[model samples]
Target: MAITSANQLELLQTAEAVAREKMIEPELVIEAMEDSLARAAKSRYGAEMDIRVAIDRKNGNATFTRVRTVVDEELLENYQAEFTADQAKPYFEPQKNAQNIWLRDGAPVEDFAAGPQIGDVFQEQVPPVELGRIAAQSAKQVILQRVREAERDRQYEEFKDRAGSIINGIVKREEYGNIIVDIGRGEAILRRNEKIGRESYRPNDRIRAYVKDVRRETRGPQIFLSRTDPQFMAELFKMEVPEIYDGVIEIKAVARDPGSRAKIGVISYDNSIDPVGACVGMRGSRVQAVVGELQGEKIDIIPWSEDQATFLVNALQPAEVSKVVVDEDAPRIEVVVPEEQLSLAIGRRGQNVRLASQLTGLDIDILTEEEESRRRQAEFNARTQLFMDSLDLDEFFAQLLVAEGFTNLEEVAYIEQDELLSIDGVDEATAEELQARARDVIEAANREALENARGLGAEDSLIEFEGLTPQMVEALAKDGVKTLEDFATCADWELAGGWTTVDGQRVKDEGLLEPHGISLEEAQDMVMTARVMLGWVDPDELAAAAAADAAEDGDAAADAAPAEDGARTEEAGA
Candidate 1:
């Protein structure tokens, strides 16, 4: 192919066709063509020379030019493309003469005295090259590669924002147990594990999936689709429920067992909406639509509550809860249900409680009412035994102390004397004697723990950290954290215990001080305090940072107040 005037328009027409087919901008295609033409020109001319091509957007006329840059004498390396400032005088002489001519003719003359300095560029028009077979083949490859890259870019930009949305696609093929779906303008992959159980598809079968993710890879944009995602069901409900679509009702949380049962917590902003009923729809139409799409997966649509206990109770629906005990520090809940409802509350193989745990973001232990009563009785007996042994009290006196909520010697030793006196048949003298005995037991236990910690190489720095108790120090020493520095280096989660995700399941990480009832926040404060005491962190700097954070929070709250007030005013007007 030759670069001739007759075929210049053909170049633009070909570029437009390729761009339309690739779904990319025509200008990008033209830029690619210009690059390919420049490469061909470089081959025809000297490869060391800087050759560039520009196609006029209006007429598609190709212009080839050789570019040389003026550089410092020491920096000039490429002879054909770069020249020292001293060697550029010849190129600037003509421009200087042109300026004089303009000045003599009373025409405006811009300054040209400091002409052709370093870093200045010079361009000269060059004859167009005739493309030989080899050069033409190379140019074709360049254009194709560039077009493919632009197509990939277009696909990535199109789908990146569509993540977390539902998309409809036709099944294209199956590769290694992964379903390839033809989402218009691109392809997406639905992994085998992301599909609902036993959901098989043949080529050309239409499928709806959640756009779980869009990642840019070397080959192309990877769009990950999922049918078993919890969000998929929530999205289906949003599609079928007008109230959810309109924001009058919101799906707060969703937990799915894929092909089995699922639970979704919903809340209504409008008092009259009844989010659960709205999602269920008339005659179960709305929920049935979702269930059918999920392959007959039963869904429990429960009302969302700010109180986690209430929400958990609702999440374990069709199973009556007798009582709820929440352990906030551990973030676990114990739900007591009647003996008959125990099986239903736990579901088949604990599925109900598992879904409730996921929905409420807490670990749930479901026990029958009888089991709960026994556990409480055991705890009461244990406390009574401790009081009897530590305070030297009789069985009735120990039972009285346990019933009054004195669980340990520490509480009895530190509590107000009036509290013990308030117990039935307890006088001031009896209370005093009980407190004295309780203090002696607690002190003796502390001394014993300190002795053991010291035996285990516990240092005075750790023992005197103030926030940590003697037992906590002993535990730390047993765990090899025998110094204040070691304690400071420990993470808050390591000090208070936390759950970690392992193999898609949460596993408990036991903490050294967890048995001592140290909360995560308290552990953090103690660690930071230790760091400050050891001079690892400056307390003044910490104070300044905290003040700055408080100021930013105050500013943000102040900024939000006006917007909230305006919204309220608008609502009142409405």
Candidate 2:
């Protein structure tokens, strides 16, 4: 192969053909050709010479050149390609009137007298190389390598933004239980675990899957598709329901026991359109479309509610809920159902409750009405026993305290006198006696806990920390945090129990002071206060940071307000 006059245009034609086949820019292919030609020229000329090739985009003419750069004496390492400033003077002699030559090279304009400034370049046209058999093969390999890289880059850029969408493709083949799908412009992998149940595919079979992820790997752009994702079901609804696609109704949440059962919570922006009815469609047509795609997976379309209890009740469909007890601090809920509805609420193998948990983003505990009553009775008896032993009261008096919602000695000891007096048969003197007994018991327990903490080598500094109770101090000491310094060094999550994700499940990490009713926010405040007291943190700096954070939050809220108001105004105008 040679860069002859008759064949010059052939180079550009080949580049365009390759670029079109690879779906990349033609300029990229031309640049790769230039690199391969330059390498071959270097092999033919002196190997040390700096050779470069450029192809004219308009006429497809090839220009070969040798370049040498003027550099500082100490930095000039390649003798053939770089020259020291002194050796480059001849190249600059003809351009003596070039304005501010010294200044352009970082010297003062007033000192504009120039020999050859460092970084000045010299170039001369060179004869094009005649490629022999081995040289042609080497150039071909270089061009192929560059073209493959450009193709990969183009593919990555094309698919990166397409993730989280649904795509249709033809099944190419199966490799190691993974289905290879030809997605027109690129190939995608549908991993075995991402398939719904025992779904199988053969070559040339058409498949629709969620674009779960798009990653740029060393080999190529990897597109991962999934059929078992909950978002897959949500997207299917969006496709089938016109209201969803038009944003009249929004899918609030979706939970799927892929191939078995799924639940989708939806809400409508327009009150006229019922989200559930719109999703279910006339005669269940729209829902049936989604269900058919999901391999007959049963779907429960429920109307989403801001009230969690109401939403949970709706999520557990065809079952009667007697009551819902929500513990906001624990972020868990208890649902009490009728005895007959217990099995339905739980579903087969607890699938109903599990999907409901996923949909609500909360852990759920289901119990029968009879079981709830038993648990309540047991709690009442425990509180009654506590009052009887701690206050030296009769069982009837204890029962009265429990009935009045007095659960602990702390409330009995610290509550307003009027509250205790409001109880039937309780006079001022009786109320005073009851409070005195409660306070005595509380004080004794605190003193015992403090003594134990001191025995465990707890420092006076730790014992005197304002936020920690005696029981909290004792718990910290038991956990080897016996000093104020140790307390300050602890993480907020270590001082207050938090949930951690382990093996794809959220597990609870119990904290030392958790049993003492310490919240994460309270723990953070106490630890920061301790650091400030120990002169480890500046209170002024902390206040400044907090102020900046609040300002940012205010700005974000302000930005959101107008958009919401505009939506409301539009609705009103309509």
Candidate 3:
């Protein structure tokens, strides 16, 4: 009996010790203690009995009890859980009544209700005894399981919001090329692919990595970390450089080649503060610290400019840039470097140019000064010859047109007469003649294209549709979309995307429409117009159907305009 009482006290003391070890609240541990004890009691008692255990939080005192509830003999439906056959046996005879607690005359018996009132809880103290070995093991298992669950929940809550921040941990071990770090409260995994290629770590070595994700799994919360991520290097700079931390200098963008090289584009908000000098610190002390942490990765700090061309030149550092021709529409840049600097601009294996593209967010094509000059000459000759052939102009007149930025017949035909006449070597008579010839050639070309497309079995409805270019109609015919009905039945993706498959399976039919350089909404509008022309749907009906579909798909905001021209064209996302 003394041993049994000592075991009861040990239960509460064990819970407190486990709670402190697991860094959980003592209250949670006590709850575990009660649950484990109750499980052991249930094993000793019958499975159907109401057995419960409660541990006092203030002391180690425990209460073991068998719980029952009071019930009204007159009301059987509400007292099902608490009512038992033995309690009602007193009222039942050899043949039980409809209400088991009622007398044979169908009247309720009042004898059983005086002891315990209806809807009252009744608990009976249980005697102390030695729990069987199996039941004791069962209690320990329950306590461990509950404690583990609570610990997992706490760890998840602790690291959920720490993603994207830099974290420090000690390298505990490595398995299958992945490093496992022992963070203060939990473990983090840095996969082999996330580590810098030129670096290595030994056991107990401290390291810093970016927290990429914290995912809850069946076993526990997995903290995925990365060291080669561009954001990781950027965060390191944010820590080493005070200007960036205080928001005086903004790190516009970062591109890294892991331990080999990296580039950072920075911009200053204040006119007096120089972003590069501040990041470099006094005598390059700040940047050196960052570089040392990165395993001697070369760092290039470039000043960011709103003018993308200027920024690109700055990003391609250690290489001189002579000229930059920007195509804003294509979002590409043609950079011309001196012959002596071509190899430097391109770098060894194109690393320099690659990083420049990432930093500026533009496609860069590097060209030598000589190659650029030759390309410019070729463009000039091509434009000059085009004008001479289309308008029957002499080389002198074509040269003037090309120099004035008139590259096409449409420009020459639609340009204001005054603007054309104001050109250096052009007079009003010459401009009028150029405009007449341009208009005549354009009309002739349109007639020929329509005739060609019609002969290819294109419907007059499609030929007359102004939205599609002549080439578009020709391409449609080759794809078996000649008639208006064929055009109306085409799906939006067939005309917009060339291919998008699912799980290595083709989602689109073979030989279907391919991308014609338009968005899906544009393709949809084309189909709608064909339907309206074929008399399959009235314009207003087509508009209503499109709006209804858009609203149903939760895309009404993109097509909010009334679908007067068939359905309103859906714009590409910003």
On TM-score, the candidate that comes out on top is 1
lDDT for each candidate structure: 0.85, 0.86, 0.76
TM-score of each: 0.90, 0.89, 0.71
Instruction: Rank candidates by lDDT, best first.
Output: 2, 1, 3
Report the C-alpha displacement of residue 183, candidate 3, in angstroms.
Answer: 1.6
Off by over 4 Å in 1: 95-110, 532-574
Better of 1 and 2 by TM-score: 1
| lDDT leader | 2
Q: Between the candidate structures 1 and 2, which one is better when assessed by lDDT? A: 2
lDDT of 3 by residue, 1-574 (tens): 2224664567667777888999988778889878877777766666656777766665566677765554666554434236644474343333243212333123444455444345544445675435677877887788889999999988999999999999999999999889999999999999998998846789999999999999999899999999898999889889988889998788888988788888888877777777788788777788888888777788888887767667788888779889889763332479999999999998878888988887877778999999999999999999999999999988998998899888788899998999898888778888898899999998888777667777789987766675776667777777677877777888876776534558944354332334335666677888877777778879987779879887877774653322111111110100
Query: What lDDT tens digits, residue by residue, belong to model 1 across residues 346-436?
Result: 9898898999889988888889988999999999999998887777778998998888887788898889888877888999988888878
- RMSD to true structure for each model, in Å: 6.1, 5.4, 10.8
TM-score of 1: 0.90
Off by over 4 Å in 3: 1-11, 34-56, 59-131, 392-394, 424-433, 440-470, 473-574
Candidate 2 lDDT, 439-468, residue by residue in tens: 999999999999999999999999999988
Question: Model 1: C-alpha RMSD to truth?
Answer: 6.1
